[model samples]
Target chain A: MNGTFDPPATGKRVIPGTYVFDGDAARRGFAINEMCFSFNEDANRRAFAEDEEAYMERFHLSEEHKKAIRERDVIGMLNAGGNIYYLAKLAGILKLGVQDIGALQTGTTVDEFKAALLAHGAKLKELQTQGETA
Target chain B: MSTIAGGIFTSHVPGIGQAIAKGLKQDPYWKPFFDGWHTVHDWLKREKPDVLVCFYNDHGLNFFLDKLPTFAIGAADGYRHEDEGWGISGYKPYPGMPELSWHIIEQVVHDEFDPTMCQKMLVDHALAIPVEMAWPDEEESWPFKLVPIAINTVQYPLPSPKRCFEFGRSVGRALESWPGDEKIVVMGTGGLSHQLEGERAGHINIEYDTFCMDNLSRDPEALLQHSSLDIAELAGSQGVEILNWIAARGAMRGSVTELSRNYHIPISNTAAATMLLENHETVLA
Candidate 1:
């Protein structure tokens, strides 16, 4: 119960729609982030691609962290303390962009995620027109 | 004496850098965005400030989760373009001002805004992209001295929007009191909207972004009422980078005359924006 005071923001526990990569989350995801950070190097990216499990184990990530990596779970990794910036390196290994992570978290296809972004542009144009008229 | 000549606020989206790197500025997809900078390029050519104190957040170039500084200043003579996971090619090194960097570091610390000093740093797109956009003719090299300031907006426990404003004020004071005739420009880059990753992944709040830009030059203080969470929720997680814009506004001291402003959407997962503001005192009499 030591984590008692650390109540989640809402009844849903996780912050709705986002995972903030804060200090405590950084602490929790240290090993996982360290492994991901190493992917900055082409050699490190290649090493992980060659032998995923062995490469992950070298970082000594916890079972939960390892599982999240194994499953390619972006949100799970976030819950386990994976900062999205660092997790992006892992996402890179999987050829996934931030949109892919968004798609996975929101349960949408990549094309749909892209469509939503394009729609945002349409919405902006509409708002600009309204502003001009007003 | 050194003076805070003006402030330039813009979005330094990574894709903008890619477009420049790949020579795709003329492509229809990028033409509109690049067109926005045409005025900025002409403006920089005329202003040609001696030094530019560029403020931006690092994604994952120089600092990792191991040891991240809340506020860090680069005092090196130059910085090379970081690979940033994907390769970044053909970016010439940016010149730095070590003398002015040390003076501000000392003065701002005295002003109680303790920023970490990085003697060497590989600056990522957040700082590099805006410089490139403003000075599109890369063959001649960067004209102004750059003092790269990296704020920790990436991880949690980010400096409050209010605190960021205060920090910029301290830097402004430092620039003001410094013993030099150097013309200085403060640049705050990043954000309008568009979240990169999360359940609300392609989230773009034009209203919030518009509200921010419309009011930034007039009542930047009004924005403080909107907490970081309010910004993140209304804008996006990465949208919090607007704090740097608030800081840039603060560096201008009080009311500034806006010379130019532009806002465009979908510049690589963010709503891109630019504003050129001159200090009230420095404006034509």
Candidate 2:
């Protein structure tokens, strides 16, 4: 394998116009970014900690589902299919094994459990697919 | 039965393969690995794997730091290669298995795994450089068909390791269900730890890397059982990403039969390691 490069020409997507984020565009972009990446900030955590149900209302997920995940209830989150994928991230946080995150915990193989997961991730991807202007 | 050749799971530590080959062979911690893989190079000629499904991450070089896809599969008939500032001439335009790639993409997405399909993307040296050096092909055209599976690692908050591992299992299931009769090999490229950024650079834990290489090939489930935090503690912040290899292990039915594991450290910005495993019915060459 040497010097020649044959780049794939199809993956690049063309956009119409560019908008500066210094004005109204910036405000809108921040709002959207906040909406999607809301759970990580300290302020949001405190707010959600105070009124979990009300906070859940502001977002797309249900209060019960959000609570279950916040409490690290793995099975409840998985059964609910409500932001459970993120909870899988907690397996590492909790010192649980990687395979143990889902079916691998129950002594079943990964294949038996992944189809259901891909479907959930697929749905989530659709919800968050379109991003703002570059 | 198709014989299994070997699998590689290494950190794409920039100029690692070449740098290590240059001077690391003398370091006590590094010398054995160099010696071990010296044998693997010769074996590849004899074993000759027909296909390789490389799992690598684009270091903001291809897709950029702008938008990152959680899991992207190369489906184009050919890939656009990026020149890595380094003077190395890289691989020829890689031929993609569009029909099979798309078939798997559709099935996986249909089954609920959303894999971004790439037609035009830069094949960064973070991936191409080390991979080529590991098993250099001097005669021009590659000896085998290629299946490139890229994961987003550079950008913060990428797919969770659990998600990555499960993706590998899904990929394995996809391959198992593929009707084609060709022989195949799978590799998980990147990381054994040592953060490239922040103040925690140059960290190396021979024990942690050794444990990772051992468990990853034979009993990955056992390794994944530990929390990502545990892996991070053992490996380092970026090292926690080793679970990414679990994805490749997943395709091999969660059990690795044939193994080639290499570990080296402080190669540029990371502690690097590589593992090559074989799945059932596929021979490793």
Candidate 3:
């Protein structure tokens, strides 16, 4: 290190485009995340597939979790404190990839979600040029 | 003095690990990504560096919410791959270069990098996925000794891009000062713009990824200007892992000769990318 390295900044804005899975969020999502983490085992995945309710119960998921799991509600799960990484395991069980979760949250088809994501890059470039010229 | 011979930036998506494990290289979905790796495999063979200072973010394996070290370095004798709650198993143990690991850790701490030091850690997909992707051979141990540098990309208040870059420079300086004839390659495993959470989850910014990748080989300092939020704004939240890549770029303080670059979309809802760079002075000199 040439000069002293500063530690990561604390309490910054959670940028407009993200749902940060921070400490509070992690606490809220622990049960749900743990439930999803169980899917690492084939038997656990099979158990979840066999009886979603029972599987969730075994993990001691909250009522909100059950509702989120039952409804296949991405945003609901997130709001109920679902870390996307852990939610991904549940998404895997639901045959929903992260893109599907994104689409569900953003109210777009998966194709549209991808298109929108790609579009932002072009928009950012335009903004950059405008800033440069100005 | 030990030499930092090169730097590699790559995505460590677990799906890629599954695809490679299932021999899905010829599968249309995977062919492009695998095609991008041929040059990487060849470079690894040609360079045959002694060790890899691998920077990766742990998934849910070793450290979870209870205690997330903003940055952790493994000084373990060897690393065992964790199950990662996905039933994926069976990997040859990854040997560690504890001697070199301690040397760099001491230097980094002295340089005020403030990394959590680990005597032992079970590496999850974040580290294992990339290693398996690079060297698929199950029977043989990986050729290069590893110094696992785990970053906290999972939780909030993750290290800033500039901080990560400075840590890399510390490691680079440490490598240079050590009185050892070791050839080291700093490998960063993560992100090229894909957000896996929030309403902006499926975010993949090709222009952002492309622009960042382009600068990585030339003006990495330009990347330091962008904050984590700025990256999240352009890339996705998880795409913030690009800080690992920026750090690897920082390790290459000398001129870099770009060997190969590959970018592919929709690798499990992420735009996967990889790049290989050789130290122009180190290799040529």
lDDT of 2 by residue, A1-134 (tens): 11111111334321111111112322222322233235433465556557755765676565445654466554333333322213322342344433334343232344543443333334433533542100
What would the per-residue lDDT of candidate 2 be over residues B103-220, giving only the tens digit for each residue? 6687678768888888766666555654565575556676666677888654334566667777887776677677776566677766775542112223345556656666776677
Q: What TM-score does chain B alone reach in each candidate, compared with the true chain B?
A: 0.94, 0.83, 0.96
lDDT of 3: 0.78
Per-residue lDDT tens digits of candidate 3, residues A26-83? 7777898888777766788889999988888987989987887788877677767777
In angstroms, the error of model 2 at A35 is 26
RMSD of 3: 6.9
Which candidate leads the pack in lDDT?
Answer: 1
Q: Judging by DockQ against the true structure, name the best candidate.
A: 1
Report chain A TM-scores, every model. Answer: 0.84, 0.32, 0.75
Runs in model 3 deviating more than 4 A are A1-17, A37-61, A108-134, B136-139, B280-285
Query: Model 2, which residues run further than 4 Å from truth?
Result: A1-134, B1-6, B17-33, B85-90, B226-233, B281-285
| Model 1 bad stretches (over 4 Å) | A1-14, A132-134, B282-285
lDDT of 1 by residue, B26-49 (tens): 997677677777667777778778
Q: Which candidate has the top score in TM-score?
A: 1
Better-scoring candidate (DockQ), 1 or 3:
1
- CA shift at B185, candidate 2, in angstroms? 1.0
What TM-score would candidate 1 get against the native? 0.92
